[model samples]
Target: MSFLACRVFEKTESEKTESEKTSPKVQKTTIYHQLVQMETDELTAGDVLIRVDYSSINYKDALAASGRGKIMKQFPLNAGIDLAGVIVESDNDAYQAGDKVLVNGCGIGEQYDGGLAQYARVKSDWVIKIPEAYDTRQAMIIGTAGFTAALAIHRMQVNDQKPEMGPIVVTGASGGVGSIAVNLLSKLGYEVIALTSRKSMHDYLFELGANKVVSEDKLGMSDKPLGKALFGGAIDNIGGKTLSNIIAHTQLWGNVASIGLAQSPNLEAKVFPFILRGVSLLGISSTNCPMPLRTKLWHQFGKELPLPDFEAIVSKEIALEDVSPYFDELIDKKHHGRLIVNCQ
Candidate 1:
């Protein structure tokens, strides 16, 4: 069946019989096989059915949709890694029908059916209540990318990184995680230097609160184990040589949060930066982050961090049906900023 053939169904209280009122409601979801369609009775036990209002395309989502990376371990799985919506049916005491919630990573697109559809039945443990400050759209705008940035910042803060120390550099600053990191770190009073290969996005990055926008070429790789001490702290999204460069130039006792492997994953680095300069290389993993910490970071995004102009970061807003065409752009690295999927 065609994906567009999927239909949504909701039941009113009056429509339910006495026994059915307490029983979990069946939900029709846009499901994926070789094709897509609205399907019912797909939910397993202990799963909460969410009426997805919005979802966002991350690098992983793009990889999964295009079948480029080994992102989806299972075929015929729902695509899209991040979603925000309202709960329609719940088995968990922490949530109820009509509660706004969001789910990010936790192997959604990889290990289980994900959020590219009109509805999702996810494990209750993976569902986090959307903060009051954000609606479904805003939550998805932050999605996995913004959440990963916040997690990196939280780690840097724990390591005692302060604005007064020096500038915090964000490598791959035009991308989602890097963009959000630039905005968040700037808002927190750190001077942010955004590094991007796309020189065309310099003005855009500056508007997102980057104090300085530098070309990725400026971060020249060197054979020396220690380079000039430039950044006080860093949020590195591109790995390989870029990561090695960031490590070499970090100030004494500075922390560098390694969040992505957009570039090559291999790291050939000397131990001099670590043992001599006391630079700390922090590895950030958003996928399997503990629930308590995840909730806390989302709470911080809602209340503490100044919300960046999401419209500026949103490169495209397409419906679920139009998602396929954009995946190639994302995989090719031709798209900048975020791509939001309007599931509603």
Candidate 2:
């Protein structure tokens, strides 16, 4: 059976020539995306087939679909990075028909066919049985964004971070991962200082349970090797000076989780935070995360990390047909909440 998918591909010379033949004014775009019908046989090789109920639009998904970032490793693939649904078929005994499952990262969107379709075929190893705490829709609501947040927090705690150590400031607190991190961290009993570059999102961040909402302009970071310990720890999404400053201000024995480099990837800072303060900088890699830990984090989503305000965090839901135009919204940074795609 053929199903509709948001397919991303590069036009071959023949295809482009054929296109120019049809429309004399234009040849073809370098990277193109559209809704197209595809059969299971055309899907990338995998052992498990999933009837995808929902998938979320993430930063990487937007980047891949819009061709604004060099994220896709192959052409002729679907573009969503995370999905939740029910298993329809599985070659492995560990899974059976009708079991709820979710998949994020593991190279599905970039190197293989991904979740931006009504149906998906993925490696059995990439599948996680959705815990009862979250249905398919809820799973996509959290999606890859929440998975990264949970992994960051988990790592921080494992590194001996505690609420009593001091407040945890979340950088880039207006984005998907940052917003969810704010909500979850506040609920987890840590004092959360949400940092956003936009002053308009301060109220929204506070609504997500941030004890304090701040912007970089409001905070004066020091040039000293180790600045005043204003925070116990930090979950930094935007790297560069912000990351360096966060590292400088983090209290003794604190843990800092570096999740993204939205602002800049460069870092110029002294080693005092790490050497003198005994700070731990944990690198959270959700994409290529091992299956065992991935499953554990997803399970934690159903348990301790449940987001009652997922509705607030999930700003919009669009049909699969409406996926393309929305990438520009993400690209322009006009959106603050998560956007989930209803593949059904």
Candidate 3:
């Protein structure tokens, strides 16, 4: 359907009373001002209904919200990819009312209505019980970006990455995934080098536990098939030549987990890094991650990779009314760190 035309209306007490009597089955209305109003019948199909407490902005969400990219396959769909909230209704045995749960990726804000509204209906299979250590807000603070970072680290560790090998580098270091990867990798005893185009965020990266911060310009591409091995392993958020450079410079037997294509999706690199150096370029997809692995990683995030200063990574917390402008800011690359949406 075309996006619901923008309009505003409020029910009078008499209208409310009359409507309640006329349609006892209708759910309460939720108005997301400047966006759209949603009710029970309007929600996308799902087995569980969540009272979304919080959702957070991601690059994809920015694209969808700002009408800049094909992030949303359906018009009028809710457009935040990460959500944490309490379950209010469920048709699945795995979850019940009052459970604190979260949904990330799985085509949310893309193929389905997502978490920007006060409530969302989502598949039970996509729902993860919030970790014991995290509150609703904290869960969204980590959101999809942090979760993807953790997934990248998990893949690297599975490939036998060790802290003693050498330093690990995180590209796009001021962004959500990069910042959390820096924090989590440092906490795991790895020397963390953060690379960013924004020189102003160097101190911010340091505060997030980066051992060093390097300018993106310093990581220039080379014609050589392999460059000097600078990082033992890397979590790359900006793809394209940045990713190729990381692969070229990764230590022998090291792995580089590529989690995004913010710079560009194209990769122009030789097979030397993989053939001669035994380097592995791993792809991370938090969206379609298998259920068992998704659950395990989230649990590990709570137990081992907890960000004690998660609030520090949140660049802003805005109400629904403020989302439109923030979308523009995000698409223009004018914002850094995570942006939390208070959907309550």
TM-score of each candidate structure, all chains considered together? 0.88, 0.93, 0.88
Which residue ranges in model 3 land beyond 4 Å of their true spot? 1-34, 219-221
Candidate with top lDDT is: 2
lDDT of 2 by residue, 261-320 (tens): 898999887888999999888999999999998988888774766664788898889999
| True-vs-predicted CA distance for residue 276, candidate 2, Å | 0.9
- Lowest lDDT 10-residue stretch of candidate 2: 12-21
Residue lDDT tens for model 1, 52-142: 8999889987766665666766545677778899998888888999999999989887767778888888999998998778788988889
| Model 3 agreement with the true structure over 1-344: per-residue lDDT tens digits | 12221122222232345566567544453322247655766777999988888898898787676666666665567778889999999999889999999999998888887888788889998999987888999998889988898899999998999998789989888888888889889888999989987888988899989988988666554657799887898998888988888889889899899888889999987899999899999999988999888888888765766664687888899876567778778767687888998886
Off by over 4 Å in 1: 1-35, 43-46
Give per-residue lDDT, candidate 3, residue 172.
85
CA RMSD (A), model 1: 11.5
Compare candidates 1 and 2 on TM-score and give the better one: 2
